[model samples]
Target: MAELVRVAALTGYFPTMQGLGADPRPMLRECGLSPELLANPEQLISARATMRLLERSAEVTGCTTLGLRMSEERALANLGVASLLIAHQPTLRLALQALTEFRNRINSTLALQIETFGEEIVLREHFALSSPEPHRQSSDLALGVLARFCAAVLGDGWTPLSVCFAHERPSPSEMAVYRRLFRCTIEFDSEFNGLVIAEADLDRSAARADSALASHARELISSVMSPAMRTASQEVEQMIMLLLPSGRATIQYCAESMGSTVRTLQRMLDADGTSFSDLLNRARMQLSSQYLANPRTRITDVAGMLGYGSIGAYTRWHSQMFGISPRQWRASAARRQPQSSAF
Candidate 1:
């Protein structure tokens, strides 16, 4: 099943695109979405379609910063029912914790990983879409919205230590907009897409927190959670995405990560009509396509990124999957794509 995201994700999409001199309705229709659907913010829509809409809109309009533009007008209310819970947390850290806990309810495909290293905090955001399509626009939209959220909750004084993107840097003009919005250093072609924050920033108390409202919001959110909100297969797919680059995506490590034994994890997957190997293969197929389509990404690096032990193994797997070597596949993809832009 395709993961669903709330229509609220596109809160300012219409105006943002129109302001860029592009009509988003045509692209929305092309992606199986409509203005009526997006107007009903609580309605769930296909995550893949939403992502594809953003990418297509950007391409058609030649607006690389389309996502970031939409994010500029976003507010806490854009988070839908979970806004109250996230807004009332006592500190930035607590608010982020709320977001992590309720992420499935907010956007089933979205994943948040927060890690601390000494005085630095890293908040990595990922969308576990089952497709091989590029999600640059959606990724920018997410990070931009997140930056705005932190600013809204923590006050104008709050700024991340740095913002990072796994993709290459945009043009100088586009970078200016990014710098203006983030108000901090920006790193492109980095290991992940997320914010790097100072520990003190996250630890500081939130001036707007209301304990009673937070408790009430939590209750409301908890009441709506159901088994359908997430599944074992989805959880394992996310784990695979995270563990792949580390070369620890084996079933044993994945089961351990889920606090389950191999047999128990297998049972859960079996109940979901899948297995560990199947999920892993799907994840590899999705990621391999994305990585191979990027001309700058070396085949050896792609192999490493997909957790292959060696280039030969990756080559053999690629041949089996695509009936051609990685080099041929990359060449074919390059031929299909138009000339690269400055981004």
Candidate 2:
């Protein structure tokens, strides 16, 4: 349960493969996936496997836009029960909040956070970090699916103010497709990957919502949800992911958020066969790779994101964990990126 997404997360892969003129069966087999597996939306699969599949598909097909293609074909109903809960919420904000709250049931590894910046709301959808390389396919598919969901709830005319990606910018030809799809400005090399929605749009009533059905859906989902499937350490790690960017990923903060004292939290983690420091180390190691993958993220910023007070301290920790300076590691990753003709 490191991070699990639904096998059906690859729902669009078959069609996308057909479009790319590439046979997916071989690739699927290579990735340990198949059409039958993806047919079941509730079947849990490794998030890492999904990421690797997309990346490998892109690599093999010479189509760096593999994820975008999949996203473009994504249907809102593919979300299964979560779709029922989301479809009945009164407003887009409520629908999104419901999805975020219940996402663990669908994909325990994905993180969705909404940040309001004055009149704009940023919807951040985070997937698991699978490699040191830029996760273009992952980024595009995530944003594309988000766009589809926004359109689903806000009516066909709804569009975001901007769509952002942390990966390098696509070619002008590819950029044209993004512009057409998003119907707005697209930012590449962004610090984060997500949708930028107008604050006004979030409160707008969704056309398909049914309050009664929504309540029923909520009850159904909760009835079957095993909230404690995640260990104490896992819960704390997820909490840390949310709090780290805000400079609040401390043990005290996590304990307080969980409605427990620091000592009790420590005892609970100990009982679960992990320690608070071990959890923090694991989270930092995971997040550091993700943070460094974004070239726009400064080394100092990455340090701060990982909760280090100074660049020096972060560099020391990074060197210790990675066995190379952060700069050197990043440079190596850049050199290994696959070349595209569009480039």
Whole-model Cα lDDT of every candidate shown, in order: 0.83, 0.78
Name the weakest run of 10 consecutive residues (lDDT summed) in model 1. Answer: 334-343
- Pairs clashing in candidate 2? none
Which runs of model 1 end up more than 4 angstroms from their true locations?
90-94, 114-122, 166-176, 188-192, 199-212, 253-261, 294-301, 325-327, 341-343
**lDDT by residue for model 1 over 167-284, one digit each (tens)?**
7788787877798789999998775678998888887888679999999998987788676777888778877877887799999998897799999999999999999888888888
TM-score on alpha carbons, each prediction: 0.83, 0.88
Q: Against the hidden true structure, what lDDT does model 1 obtain? A: 0.83
Off by over 4 Å in 2: 129-134, 228-231, 336-343
Q: Write the per-residue lDDT of candidate 2 for residues 177-275, one digit (tens) a residue.
A: 687679988887689888999999998999898989988987887787676754677677667777776878889999998899999999988888888
Decoy 1 TM-score against native: 0.83
How far out, in Å, is residue 135 in model 2?
Answer: 2.8
